[model samples]
Target: MERKIKIFMIDDDPDDREFFQIALDMTGIRYTLKTAESAVEALNIFPEFLELPDYIFLDLNMPLISGIQFLQIFRESADLNKVPIIIFSTSSYHKDIEDTKALGASHFLSKTSDIDRLSEVVVSILKGNDLPFILT
Candidate 1:
């Protein structure tokens, strides 16, 4: 049996986190999801997890320690350096996209409200299917 894919999402908004969970459920893929409401919270808790997630979705905007800051920290951690991290954000700013890529983000995707599209993208990512991204 194939092991379920593990995904971690760090976002501040409760509504956004709910929407993302709902979208993941709609994808019909076997996945285990762990969420952190803030980047600081994630940093504190991630080290406790025995198995690192296969992928990490980070919100660009957050209260303390923004996604970029978290990315920098994550990069420094030997255990997390190789995990694929996707910058999931509402901002489509060119600078944000470029910065995320330069900082070692595997992909940059604008947060979508459409559940179907979100599900599609999640499924594609799990299956190692390529989805077009601005920076990579």
Candidate 2:
């Protein structure tokens, strides 16, 4: 049996987290989704996990430590560096995309209101497509 994908999502908004869960559920792919409302909470729980996440989705805006800050710290850890990090944010700013890409983010995707589109993007990423952004 194939192993299920492990996904970690860090976003302050509960609604956005719920949306992501819904999107993942729609994909029909085998995955375990874990969420943290803030970077601090994620960091606190990260080291406790027996198996690290296969992929991490980060939101740009948050109270205290932002996603970019979290990414820097996350990438600095030797054990966490190899995991693919995707910047999943509501911001459509070019600078945000450029910054995260320079910091080693695997992909940057704008948060979509459409759940189906989000599901498609998740499927593409899981399939190992090299595209930086998933065009609707």
Q: Which model scores highest in TM-score?
A: 2
TM-score of 1: 0.94
The whole-model lDDT of each prediction reads 0.87, 0.89
lDDT of 2 by residue, 41-75 (tens): 98898978899999999998999889999999998
User: Ten residues in a row with the worst lDDT in model 1?
Assistant: 127-136
The digit string of per-residue lDDT tens for model 1 on 1-136 reads 7788999999999998999899899988888989999999999898689999999999999987999999998998777898999898998888888888888988887788788888888778778876666522
By summed lDDT, the worst window of 10 consecutive residues in model 2 runs over 127-136
Evaluated against the true structure, the overall lDDT of model 2 is: 0.89
Off by over 4 Å in 2: 133-136
Instruction: Extract clashing residue pairs from model 1.
Output: none
| Clashing residue pairs in candidate 2 (N, C-alpha, C atoms within 3 angstroms) | none
Best by lDDT: 2
TM, every model: 0.94, 0.95
